[model samples]
Target: MIDASLPEKLKEKISSFSDYKIFTHKNPDGDALGSVLALKRILEFENKSSEIFVFNSIGAHFYFLPGIEEIRIQKEFKDGANSPALFVLVDCASWGRTGFPFFDFAKKEVIAIDHHPKRTDKEPLALEIIDLSASSAAEIIFALARELNWKIDPEISFCLLAGILSDTGAFKHSNTTPKALKAVSALMKNGVNIKKIADNLFRKNEFPGQLKLLGEVLARASLEPRIRMAFSFAADKDMKRHGAEEEDLSGLANLLSGIPESRFSMLLIETGAGKIKASLRSETHKGVDVSKIARLFGGGGHKLAAGFEIEGKIEERFEMIKEKIAKESASWRI
Candidate 1:
């Protein structure tokens, strides 16, 4: 049965923590940003005060959403008079992953309304609306509205729709589950322009992004029978050369899998941001747990799809990760 106490719990949480602040993961993605902003907007309607903060910086592209002007960076929150006490970290599985490093926090209750798979760091969470089977945390937020009977406005629908498209690769990835589809379905019923959200996310790559993709594909393209791996080893110079943004890194791993016989593909992108952002794909099986591979580098996601940012060089971990995949490939086959 649907949890009867959920609505009361959320309402109580909102009412009791009327002056809470909302925090999200570093390098805020659409899902993380959208979840927090959407929740913040709804809470305000209930006379609850909340602010959305990012653990790091985001770009203008991400700021294209309706409530985009409201996001405050993590550092900005610290330097200013702190918002409210009750801190709510949205779309993140754990505190460590939240990117604020627990700065001067005194909130009695912590809430995690996310869809990311629960890792070890996710322990000690006060309230977790973590539906691992859901496509994105934004999807979970929509479900939260239905289950808790919160109003779903156009802005909320737009944010969640963007997140669904972003996290699900515009429904290209296999992580797009039945619940995901249904959540988007509900949003469409609420008057969200699914196509506009799609155009914003999938169809809006800039010139530099296109160049980066072509360069990455050219530089690190590797093949092992049916498998493919593309890599881009660049520092400041290369980024300047291509003007590639981190979001451009999102779908690179799938690029390798598109070729014939390559059932899986991986992208080992060396970022100017001092981390190797990984994206993975599987043309063969939707049950293969890529999260394990991502967990090695402190990342998490669902089976058949996952990604992470490596602290060290992609070149250093490249061989080890490749060998690891080779050893585990048989188990991954459908």
Candidate 2:
């Protein structure tokens, strides 16, 4: 159901604008792309003009999603060219996340739609539609569509289903709720091929190097028996040795979290000379809040899954993370 306070306001604002520029966070995942594309299609159906602006190229895995071809890179989107009436920020927690110089277009009204909790570091401009309980940003978009009485075609259904499937770990993650499944059911009613979508997302033809990287990561995994936490690292040299890109690091934490003795797991990858990216995951039943650890390092996400970026020597960063996790786990009864 739509929030009573915001839907009317959103309806009024959407009806008033005929042109819009949409943005999602840099290095977007399926939920971010799906939500943005679904909204763009909905706007176009209403005879309004809408365009997507993203900082990075969409991953090849997402090419199957409808409207993937329509996304524009940051270099191609000019602030004043279109004079867009509304800047719709979808699935992004903060304006800086768009990785575009949004300040240059500060005159345009903004609409922030996201499923993550608001960040304490930066305040977003314009009306906010944040629902942390929602499984994915696409779930919120689905509710918004119903409230607006917009028509849902097979393409849109496929897009929404992709978002839900990806963000919910194919409905196996903790965020999967009855409402989320109901949304999936509704989307499938449009004749979306659930199996096809699942296969395309989870059974993609992975590079042999990626498989080798995963094996190396597992082989090097370290465990803290007291905390029941497992961790691994992939330095730049490791990636080079394995012929793997940073994208290959995806799902590493989740794979480690499956260890029967592990209550939580972490994966740290050296992104650049002095930069590291950390991905954290915890068993939903373990009562571990990895997002708290993420926020400690200037990042945010849900309780079960979260990530952050930091700068330091790889060993130093790993030690620092271990200390923080140890401190956090010290208080847990488990």
TM-score of each model, paired residue for residue: 0.84, 0.92
The digit string of per-residue lDDT tens for model 1 on 1-334 reads 2255665676676666658778777778778777787888888777777677776688666767887788777554452344445677777766667666554333346677777766665256566666667778788778778877788888888888888888888897777788789888888888988877777666655585557656755576767643233333444345556666656555556665565655555666667766777776656443345666677567776566667777667657777777766666556552
Lowest lDDT block of 10, candidate 1: 226-235
Stretches of model 1 off by over 4 angstroms after superposition: 1-4, 76-84, 103-107, 121-123, 208-213, 224-237, 284-287, 323-334
RMSD per prediction, one decimal? Answer: 3.5, 2.3
- lDDT of every model, 2 decimals: 0.69, 0.83
Model 2 clash tally?
0
Superposition error at 68 for model 1 (Å):
1.1
Q: After superposing candidate 2, which stretches have Cα over 4 Å from the reference?
A: 75-78, 81-84, 101-106, 327-334
Query: Worst ten-residue run, lDDT, model 2?
Result: 73-82
Compared with the true structure, what per-residue lDDT tens digits does model 2 show for residues 1-334?
4477787788888899998889998888889888899999988888889989889677788888888898987544557654757888899767777867546544668888889887843454668898988999999999888877987888899999999999998998878999999999999999999898788778756688888888888899988886778888898888888788887778889989888888888888996557898898988777888888788788888888988888875777777777776786576643
Kindly report which residue pairs in candidate 2 clash with one another. none
